[model samples]
Target: MTGMKDVEVVVAHSGRATLRVGDVFLKVDGDPANADIEVQAIGLAPVPTPTVLWREDPVLAIAAVPGRALGALGEPSTASPAAWAAAGAAIRTLHDAPLPPWPGPDLSDIRSKLDRECEWLLANAVLPADVIRLNRDIADAALRPYAPAFIHGDLQIAHVFVEHDEVVGIIDWSGASRGDAMFDVATVTLGHEEHLDDLLVGYGEGADREVIRAWWSLRSLNISRWLIEHGFDPNVRGCEFDVLRARAQER
Candidate 1:
C-alpha cells in the first residue's frame, strides 16, 4: 500500500547519510552488515531539519508508507496512554538489547563540539570573559562518565512510532551507537517532559532519574552553545546563554 515515488525524504539540516537503501525502507550505514532486511520499514522525523539526500542504490531499503514520521503522534500526553506505554516498553527493550560493538561519539566527542563552539565564540567576543570557565566546567562534567550502550543519539518524541496503542516500530537509528544510554534519556527528558514522565512510568524506577536530569540539563547547556555559535543566524543562543548564566549565578 506504499509507493516509492510518494515516499519523499527531506532533511532540514545538512549531514551525512545515516542509512540508504533502494529495495528496503531501513538501512543503517555504520554497520552495514548488521542491518536487518526482514524489517518491513523504518520511519524518522526530522529533529533539526535533515538535508534529505536520495540514492539510486540504497544501502538498505524496505517497503513503507511515507506517512508523517513515527514520533508525530501528538503532544507528549495527548496520545493514547496505551501508545505511550508501548513506546516506553519498546525503548526499554532497546536498552536491554546487547550492546553493539559499534562505538558512538562520546562525551569527549561532545567536548570537541563544545570546544569548537567555545573557540569560535571567544574569537568572536560573543562569550564574556567570566563565562568561559563555567562553560568549560559543564563540558568537563558531561565528558566524565565512561558509560556506553546502544543509544539512539537523537532519541526524541519525533523519532518513535506507535499503532493500535502499541509501539510498532522505531525510526531514525541514524545516531544509534554503543554510547551513553543516559544521553538518550536526557534527550527525551530535556525536550519532551510529558512523554518522558509517561516513559518513566513504563521504565519503572530502575535507573536514577536525577542522573538523567543532570545529564539533560548539562546537555542543554551544550546544545544551546552549539546552536548559538553555529546554527542560529542572529545569535538566538545568546539568549539561552544568558539564561544559563543567570541559573549559574543563582546556584
Candidate 2:
C-alpha cells in the first residue's frame, strides 16, 4: 500500500468509507462483520465481482472492476438496451445460483419494517398522508412469501457495470443474501422504469409485474428516510420522491 498519491474518496459515511487509490479500492466498514460478509459474498456470486486484494479487520482492499457503472440515479442511461438486458441476465444467473449461506430478512420482518417506515413517514410528514396510504396498500403485495434466491440486496443501477453491451461486473456485495428475486429486479429498474421491458426480456418472461411494482413502493418508502439522514436528497429529480408521486398519480 505505497504510492498513495491520488487517493480519492469514493463514499464516506458514519457506517462505511470507500476510497480509491490507483486501480484499487479500499473499503472500511464500521463493522468488521460487514467486511467479512462482503468478502464471502463476492466469493459466492456467480457473476463478476471485484477481486479481493487483501483484508485487515475492518478494512478490505479490492481490485477495481472494469468499465463505468450502468448509470446513475436521476440521470439518463447511455447504456444500450442490450447492456441493460445483459445486466438482467446476470441477475438471473445470480438468482439461479445456490443460495448464499446467509438468509435475508424474512417476510414477517420485512412487513414489520415496512409498517415502521410507513409510521415514520406519516409522523414526519414526509409525504401526503393519502399518498403514503396508497403506496402502503400497493406495497402489501411485495411482503408475501416467495422462494428465496441469491440476491444482490442492493442492486441499484450504479452497482452494475457494463462495457460493449455486456455486464463487466457488479459491485457492493455487502448486502447480498438469500431473498426475493423480484426485489433485485425492482431495485435495478428503480428510477429507470422505461427499461423494464428490455430487462424482463432478458430475464425471461412471466415475472409478476404487480409484485415488482409493490417492491418499488416498498423500497422507496423504506430508504427515503435513510437517504435524507445521510445528506442525500431523495426529492431530487427521478429519485424516490418522484417514484412515490408517480404512484400516487396512478391511483
Candidate 3:
C-alpha cells in the first residue's frame, strides 16, 4: 500500500478504493455545473473531496454516503424509471466535462499484450482457443480510428444511483478516459431502451454521437477479447470484459 500519513479510508472497489485527505476530494466535488469536472464526477458531488477516506487507489471516486446511498432507492432495482433518469442526468453532467488521460493499454497494441497474456495462460493450461479467436476479431475492430471524447470506460445503470426520481450521482469512474463518448450507449440499451431516451435527452449537448458509437463498438470487441484471453471465474480485471461482451450483443 502507499503511504498512509496523507490518506484515510473512504470507499473500496474490487480493484481500487476512494479516500479523503483534505479540502480537495479526489473524485467528489460539489460542482455539477463546472465543465472542468470529469463525466464520472457526477457521483462524487454528494461526497466531500480532497479527502482520502478509503485509503485505496481507486480508478474512480464517489461521495462515500453514510447510512444509505439513495435512501429510498436502496440497492440497484429495475423498478424505477426515475432511478435511470437520474443516472442519465449524472452521466450527462459527466459527459459535459473534460476527460482525463487514457491510462490503460492501447487497443492497437492490445494484440501483443493479449498474445503474451494468452501464451502465459496457455502455459498454465488455463487458456481456451475459441475464446481467443473471438477476442482477436474484437480487437481488430476496436483499433479503427475514431473521434476522441470523454468516455466513462465502464458506463452502466448499475454504476448509477438515484435518490428521488432525480439522478443524484454516478459511481465507478475507474475506466474514465478520453475516447468515443458514445461508448456508454451500448450500456444505456443493455436491459431496455426505456431510459435511453431520457438519458440522451438529459445528456444535453457537447457529444459527437457518431464517434461515441464507434467507440462503443470497439469497447465491446475489446471486452469479448478480454473474456476469451482470460479464463472465466471473473473476479478480476476480466469482469469489465464480460460486461462489454454482453452489452455489445444487445439489440
Candidate 1 residue-wise lDDT, 1-251, digit = tens: 56554433432233223323342343434444334211211222212222223323335444432323334322333556666666666666666667655566756677777767656656766657456546555445456665565566677665665667666545555566777766776565444445667776665556556456555445645565445544553223324454345435533
List ranges where model 3 is wrong by over 4 Å.
1-63, 66-79, 101-107, 110-145, 188-194, 204-221, 224-251
TM-score versus the correct structure, for each prediction: 0.61, 0.96, 0.49
Model 2 Cα lDDT, one tens digit per residue, 29-56: 8798788778899998989899999999
Best-first order by lDDT: 2, 1, 3
Candidate 1 lDDT score at position 18: 36
Which 10-residue window of candidate 3 scores lowest in summed lDDT? 66-75
Better candidate by lDDT, 1 or 3:
1
Best by TM-score: 2
